[model samples]
Target: MRCLIAEDHLLSRRVLKELLSPDFDCDIAVNGREAIDSFVLAHEAKRPYDVILMDIMMPEIDGMEALKSVRSLEKKMQIPSHLAVKVIMITALGDPHTVIKSFNECEADSFIVKPLTRHKLATELRKLNVLK
Candidate 1:
């Protein structure tokens, strides 16, 4: 699988890369704007990511905004819902409101609360059927 990890923290990004790179082709973006650019570039290149791990609190644009943009882009491109990139919100915020917003408004495929663990990530991916 191809994955984009959008995280502002250096250590978190590094750890996520390490965990995912073993099984996926992983790319890193430090913030939401960069994540959007990378996503667009990949799509334009016909090499769209299969999954995105987006951090909710980033400089410039936030993950919620980025997720909306990504879904909009997919809609604009007329990509079928099944073919749309799966987005998993990665956030330190564990509040019910944020979680509800992620799923209800942003329409994330899944979520992982920080501090992220390999098992938790794998479980979410499994729920999405991104992993066996």
Candidate 2:
């Protein structure tokens, strides 16, 4: 599977890539803007990502905005929600409002808290059916 790790923190990106590299051919984006650009380019190249691990607080565009834009692009391309690229919203925030918004408003396939571990990553990926 192909996955995009969209995060601003170098350590966080490194850790996530290390964890996912076994199962995923991973791409890194330093911020939401790069994430969105990569998403579009991949689509245009006919090799869209299978999943995106997006950090909510990012420079340039922010994950929430990028999420919305990505969904819109999927819709424009006639990709149904079920067939759209899965998004696992990654965040340091644990507040109810943000979590709720990430699910209800942003329409993330899953959410994982920061200080991420192999266990947490596997559980969410399994739920999304991206991992066994």
Candidate 3:
């Protein structure tokens, strides 16, 4: 699978890539704008990302905004709902409001708490059927 990791923190990005690299061909974006551009580029290349791990707080644009924009792009392209990119919000904030916004408002496929572990990520992916 192809995956995009959008995060501002270098260590976090590194750790996530290390964890996911074994199972996926991964791309890294330092911020949300880069993430958006990468997503569009991949789509235009006819190889859309299967999953995106987006950090909620990032420069240029926040993850939430990027998520909304990505969803809009998918809709514009008329991609079927089941085939649309699966976005898993990665955030430090686990408050109810943020959870609701990410899942309900933005339609994120799933979420991962900060200080993420391989086990947690794997569990979420399995729950979403991105992994067996």
Candidate 4:
């Protein structure tokens, strides 16, 4: 699958890439704006990303905002229902309120904590049915 990773931290991005490389074709975005731009460009190119791993905190346009933007764009563009990309939010914050908000209000497909282990990531991917 084609995946996009939106993360500001270099080490986190690198670790995710290393962990998921065997299972997917991945693209990296340093910030939320770039993530949105890359997603749009990829979709326009007929190579839409299957999933996106988004970091909550970012320099330009936070992940939640970016998620809303992406959803809006998908609606505006009339993208097919089946072609909608899934977004999984990743962060170090473990606030229950934020997690609840992310699930109910932000409409994230899933949430993953930072400093992830390969086993945990794999399990999460399996839960999403993104892993074989």
- 19 Cα displacement, candidate 2 (Å): 0.5
- Write model 1 residue lDDT over 83-127, tens digit each, in one string: 999999999999999999999999999878898999999998889
> Candidate 4's error at 94, in angstroms?
1.2
Per-residue alpha-carbon lDDT of model 2 for 1-132, expressed as tens digits? 899999999999999999999999999999988999999998998889999999999999999999988898899999977789999999999789989999888888898887788999999999989898
In candidate 4, what are the lDDT values of residues 1-132, reduced to their tens digit? Answer: 999999999999999999889889999999999999998999889998888999999998999888888888998999875667878899988799878877777778889887788987787778777887
The TM-scores of all predictions, comma-separated, are: 0.98, 0.97, 0.97, 0.93
In model 1, the Cα lDDT at residue 8 comes to: 93
- For all candidates, the clash counts are 0, 0, 0, 0
* Per-candidate RMSD, Å: 0.7, 0.8, 0.7, 1.3
Superior by lDDT: candidate 3 or candidate 4: 3
| Model 2 lDDT, full chain set | 0.92
**lDDT score at residue 38, model 1, on the 0-100 scale:** 95
Error of 2 at 14 (Å): 0.5
What is candidate 3's lDDT per residue for 1-132, written digit by digit as tens?
A: 999999999999999999999889999998889999999999999999999999999999999999998999999999999999999999999998999999888889998888799899999988877777
Q: Give the Cα lDDT of each candidate.
A: 0.93, 0.92, 0.93, 0.87
lDDT of 4 at 73: 90
TM-score of 4: 0.93
